[model samples]
Target: MNSVTKARYDGLADWYDDRFVTGAEPHQPGLLELLGEGSGPCLDIGCGTGRNFETIRASGREVVGLDYSSDQLRLARTRTDGPLMVGDAAALPFPDESFDTVMVMWVSTDVDDFGAVVREAARVLRPGGVFVEYGVHPCFNGPHVVYNEDGGRTAHPTYRQSGWHEPAPWWGEDGIRRQIGMSHVPLADYLNAFLTAGLTVQRFIEPEGPPVPHSLAVRATKPA
Candidate 1:
């Protein structure tokens, strides 16, 4: 993880917790659906403020939450007694095949190398283990897209652009993107990261919401 990214999240930890404390985040239902009834030990990468701790634990899976920001993990303590650590998603401090399930939620845009993070997630996952990725839909969301007043989105020709982008004027003044900007990963690059990590894609979903789908979820597994 980038130090700047860590600092950004650290500063926003409190605001972020308060903003989503209601647990009504739109992408959550689909995230849980793709997560399925968890099994064995699970790793919740980028588990900001432990938002998904209850859902993951509800399935009887023991979860270890990890994030790049210590401040984020500090707040996560209040949500769950589960083990929380300050760590990089791209270089997980764990042994090979250490987890039966690995899930990363809303972290792609924050990481410097999304592919490297996926590779690390795959490395820690045991054979036949499941890997879940749920986050903003790359094709329809990101700096390349402009949201209009009528609930319509105009995707600019910059869909192929990948990397950190300046905050767009359309972004909410109080939004996370406006605060720290965003990194854009084109649709193909986003999906290719899993394939390159030797994960077999099982399911891909564009969850229902808004005039255009804002989020996506993917379920994959390491070959047994």
Candidate 2:
């Protein structure tokens, strides 16, 4: 991730809730429900503003939140009563099998080293521990870009591989903004990454929750 993008989010920390976290549009609740309750330490990767900390901790599990943005960490501290670390998802500062469960919710694609992050998540998880994540639907959700005036209605690319090469488009209620995101990885990449990392596939769901044509939820377990 670029320092400028990190800084931009850092600057938006105070108002991130309004800009993005007001509701469950990202489906954190459904992911949590799928994870159920586990009696072990939990590591939340890219835990911006600790939005999911309370729910994860409510299951009587010790929670540790990590994010790369300092400004976002500040907001997380205010919202959560758990340990917080200003750290990178690709380079987690913990020992092997340090956590009982690792959760990466809706933030993997945003990361540059998506594979490394997944590997690190598996490394920190204990034997038989679960690793869960939710990400944008690469199939139906295309990169949408909205330019000022001339850049009128934008369309999400129908295909993932080809579309990723093109610049992503975005149009918020506020105005037109250009977004640069990662390549649209296929479902196989997500599955193979965990399997290659030594985590056994437990569940894979492509939720059809209306308005969201495609959203993925994956749960894998490290073999004992």
Best by TM-score: 1
Q: Residue-wise lDDT of candidate 2 within 1-224, one digit each (tens)?
A: 23534754677665776666666454454676657778867898888887777678766677789888888888888877778988878788999999988988666455655677889899999998888877765454434422334423334443445313444334344421233234445556666767778888878877656443446878888899
User: What lDDT, from 0 to 1, does candidate 2 have?
Assistant: 0.68
Compared with the true structure, the alpha-carbon lDDT of candidate 1 equals 0.86
Models 1 onward score TM values of: 0.95, 0.80
- In model 1, state the lDDT of residue 111: 83
Instruction: Name model 2 segments beyond 4 Å from true.
Output: 1-5, 23-27, 142-183
lDDT tens digits, residue span 1-224, model 1: 57878978877888888887545663366767777786667899999888888778876688799999898888889978778898999999999999999998888889889999999999999999989998889988887888788988989877787988877777778877887678989998999999999999999999877868888889999999
Q: Candidates' lDDT values, in order?
A: 0.86, 0.68
- In model 1, pairs of residues that clash are none
Backbone steric clashes in candidate 1, count:
0
